[model samples]
Target: MQLRHFQNEFPYLVKALLSAKKAGRLSHSFLIHNDDGKLADDFSISLAQALACTNPLPDGDSCGNCVVCKQLEHRTYSELFTLAPVSKSRQIVIGVDDTIPDTMRWFRSLFHMKSSMAGGIKIGIIYDADCMNDESQNCFLKTLEEPPPSSHVLLVTANPFTLLPTIRSRCQSILLLRNKTSYEDEKIRGIAGIMWELMSSSNKISTAEECAFAMISISDNLEKFAEEKADVKWDRIFEDSKYLEPPAKKRLEKQHEAAISAEYLKMRDSMLSLIHSWSAQAYMLSCGIPRDSIANPELFPRDLNVISSIDPEKAYRMMRKSEDLLQILNWNVDTDLAFREFCMGVEFGK
Candidate 1:
């Protein structure tokens, strides 16, 4: 997850950052844009390490074995501060805030403290910076305008355009494009791989139940992950709220539920996007497109012979059907029912 790992994908950006670090011309604020959350966060850490590493390689990469690099890896670095959305049911939530929260206030207060470590530059990262409400974003502007002498502020967001123009003006922008090689979910990959296999199979689908099973497996895994995430957040949120009044507590509960649901829908849409891509590629193959030109070659079937028999019209229909299902899901249709109906229609409606 270091800059070196992404050299093949984002060579220009990596080279620029390295050159900046090497020349001592690093900007005080950086706004990195990427919808892929984990990769961006990891790159932020690696960037921070490069900026603060006591001993760096000639190419301005962190040695990774140095004390500062090791501290960052373990999240024990005193000079590093990370602000990401709070978790609600395994989903990161910036929350709907009219004003800044106590945590944000506390984070803002840290600039007053002198670095306890030898590293001169303290790194402050705001993960999902776009999630900040208007009030919080305005409050956060001060740091960008007049940051400490030896501090670097890194703002990471999937959608940079959501930020106020003033905020965007103050920082350098780096856009990280999606690459199939970077996708990491084994189960989703497995489901997608099996899905293409089934679609290309000569045997007609046997029953609605069989088609339902595939979608259900993906849904079940997502639900389980969400539940586990929610459980963790529940313990943390309720364990210390012994003094809240009944009405206030009820309001907080409702907000929490809303945030969880919002996050779940986001995840659902992302999964559906992957399915759409696979189906679109199938359509491409049906039109005699080369296999090498497919965006996600890893998820495609090993054999291309099935493409000869696939009706280009049917493949186009399947792609459109996936888009329609996505729209149906957005309307709050029951996921299982929408997916089942979509699957059955696509597989057997001929």
Candidate 2:
């Protein structure tokens, strides 16, 4: 991730961060929240590179060809540490080890030592930052309060609301956008078709079970796609390390599996959000809003026929219900049960 990549999508954020760096007034910590996980990851990487680069541009952006930048690309930079969840399950909510505090303490200790490179900056990036449990978060607060000089912390998460208030208040928050082209247009159309059909069905109440099943099928297909992508990514890595020691190979395999599972959950959540967006549009349509005025019509053609039949009051109620279900999912409620409840609550054609 480099400044050029986000210059168009997030011009303000890019300019702000770089300007701060150039002015020698960069914040010690930042909390980045957005629906785009990939972009958030890239942004953090770019920040790290800018801070550690030996040759920076006048705007404080990293020179992509520098030795520090190359080392970062190879993941061999000694001063850049990344923290993330270590879940092996396909559950939406993941668990992190209780030793995060210890990790942070050790990181601080390292920062106190002489800089490893000439840049004299140590970076700590926490991906899926919201996954930290209460105990771990409490522990992390200590380090946040008295962070080392010349140290920068980046906390990246899609759901920043789940993070503790104190933690959020201590950091500058930035929001990012999900690139429109990143979504699969065909899959979105399919999901929208299902929603339209469910709304137009003769027996709205009875169709709950049917709609629930359809949604599950879509979710399953998405998970499979995520798994295939992860496999393709890891195949080359494994092939290159065929002569690795037995224990090392086993560890790598485990890590690979966990990564696949995490990717699946991330994809699943994004799919669900797509569905929710459709419902939101349906609600707007129910309220006599013009179709052309609706957001994201490209993702799904507005189903005027079905939308006309839905009760505005009922659609509003269901919209709120869907949001509640999303919160429930974030709280680690059983995915199947929560989704079922949401499907059952959705009402069409009053």
Candidate 3:
């Protein structure tokens, strides 16, 4: 998508970057982060296009029809080098040999050559940058420390804490505003409904039981969804590797298992984020914030009338509790137990 497409969603960010570009003060390295990976990825591309566009719009966005913009959109631009996790382990490795593709060595070598287009900037983007192992990160860190002239590096990841503090400190960070939580899935909607009921109910004892059931249901559904997605992915790979030996096949099976676990954890984190947003909105409503100013205002709309009756201090405490729950889950605790504890511990009304 062109830069214009994101203007409505990220007007301040787009305008700031464009203004910096106009002043020839664009940072050489950036760390673009968001809970939604696709949004982060697209925004990075749009930012790069704006920097490289030969013909810019009046608002300082890239002229989408320009050859440079089109090439960047399709990722065919010679000046743009993109790297992502390619291994079954889903890692960006530091290759020992220079001939290997997408390794730190190869990525750095791209900048060593003359720019494919005269006076054009070289852009290197690392998608899922958190996948870079320690060695790979260290190798890339050198590039960040001493980047080539007229070159820009973009690191995109949903999880930024996985990156080293040194690496994070070296780049200009952009944290995108999260899009509204989507409850399009029936199961998710059910969970949201149960959560709202648990929060709003005057009878805490029975509501706790329902909250426990919702936690269990969410856990089960997350596992099933992850497994189904992994199965589809593994089947395609298995079909293409008909001649693989038994040992390799076994390794592939292990990779498939890892993929399933990864998928589950990713989805679980997303759910936790959603829960956090829910509590945050509750706190805001309790503080008398306008509905339009809050994120996910559409959630529990009918029940919002009762928010004024609830104690703002209690709502604020619940929001902090939600934050603590997220940190606790990150420690690899039992998901069901942690969720149950959180749900049961919630205090409602005054």
Strongest candidate by TM-score: 3
Which residue pairs of candidate 1 clash?
89-230
Over all chains combined, what TM-score does candidate 3 have? 0.55
The TM-score measured for candidate 2 stands at 0.48
RMSD of each: 14.6, 13.0, 10.8
Note the clash tally of each candidate.
Answer: 1, 0, 0
Give the candidate number with the greatest lDDT: 3
Tens-digit per-residue lDDT, 1-350, candidate 2: 56767887666568778998899888888988767787777778888888878889997899988877877777778877767765553112322443343244444455456676665678888788887776557767776898866788898887765677678778876656554423463553576777765655654666877777777777658767777879888999999889999999999989998988897877776676776667776776787766765556654455667457876776666655665666666776677777677777665422
> Between prediction 1 and prediction 3, which has the larger lDDT?
3
What tens-digit string does per-residue lDDT give for candidate 3 at 73-126? 998998998889998999999999767997878888876577767788789999
> Per-residue alpha-carbon lDDT of model 1 for 96-188, expressed as tens digits?
542444345556777547777654679899888877766668878887998876888999987655577688779876656465532355555
lDDT of 1 at 156: 94
Q: What stretches of model 3 exceed 4 Å from their correct place?
A: 181-350
How many clashes would you count in candidate 2? 0
Structural similarity to truth (TM-score) of each candidate: 0.49, 0.48, 0.55
Error of 3 at 109 (Å): 1.4
After TM-score superposition, the amount by which residue 205's alpha carbon in candidate 3 deviates from its true location, in angstroms, is: 38
